[model samples]
Target: MLSNFLPFLYGISVFVLLILAAKIMLNGFVSSQASLKTQNSFSKKKKDDRTGLVTVHPELLNKDGCITDEDLLTVRFAKDSDHPQSSENPSE
Candidate 1:
């Protein structure tokens, strides 16, 4: 009975190792494929000279040594009409 159990345990270990090896190989293959696809797509795109160009105004930079807080813009959201205020609790 001991000899029979030893072979069964060995078989289970070998099966587990095979599964782990297959999983690692599959992950590597998938990552490599994804990297290759990204490289190919990037190469197919046309390089534009103005694509990454940016224009900045010199006045926006701080002239003094200290930092100044400039009020650039203000944004306000309009109230939604779908959810009307309940008059049951007027104090709230």
Candidate 2:
């Protein structure tokens, strides 16, 4: 009888440990997701600040100088371009 009870007690302890481990993992996932959401919101807000400036391709300045709907669609921020000056550190 004692031998049978030992196996039963072991199984119950193992089950409780598994449940505790799952709870710990779930809590960690929830906190990390919340932190990730906060980080994404911060980055989105920074991007919104830069969107106030819209620059067009310099070649578009020449004849057929008029900006069309398609040209407007292609406009982007000057600081976001591939220019060397845009990549330079402000502190330098």
Candidate 3:
């Protein structure tokens, strides 16, 4: 009789756990909504330039809640075509 009652007890416990899991998920207790909000906020974030370039990082912000003014460093990459061709390398 005890052995037969064990399966029934297990089934009831499993059903209770499933119900709790469903309730937690439906109530958004896993913070999925908060993460989605942060992702959407980044998409709507303002850039430092009017050309829509140069995303200002959060670390660059000053204590006054503004982006600190600093010179932006840029490097011009030399394309292969822009490089001087050597005579040894036959130009196709």
Best candidate, TM-score: 2
| Model 2 ranges with Cα > 4 A deviation | 47-92
lDDT by candidate, in order shown: 0.75, 0.77, 0.77
Candidate 3 residue 21 C-alpha distance from true site, Å: 3.3
Candidate 2 residue pairs in backbone clash? none
**Residues 42-77, candidate 2, lDDT per residue (tens digit)?**
887786545577767676565677654342333567
Worst 10 residues of 2 by lDDT: 67-76
Predict model 2's lDDT versus the native. 0.77
The regions of model 3 sitting more than 4 angstroms off are 23-30, 48-92
lDDT tens digits, residues 50-83, model 1?
Answer: 4577545565557773443574543445874565
Model 3 has an lDDT value of 0.77
* TM-score result, candidate 1: 0.47
| Cα lDDT for residue 24, candidate 3 | 88
TM-score per model over all chains: 0.47, 0.48, 0.36
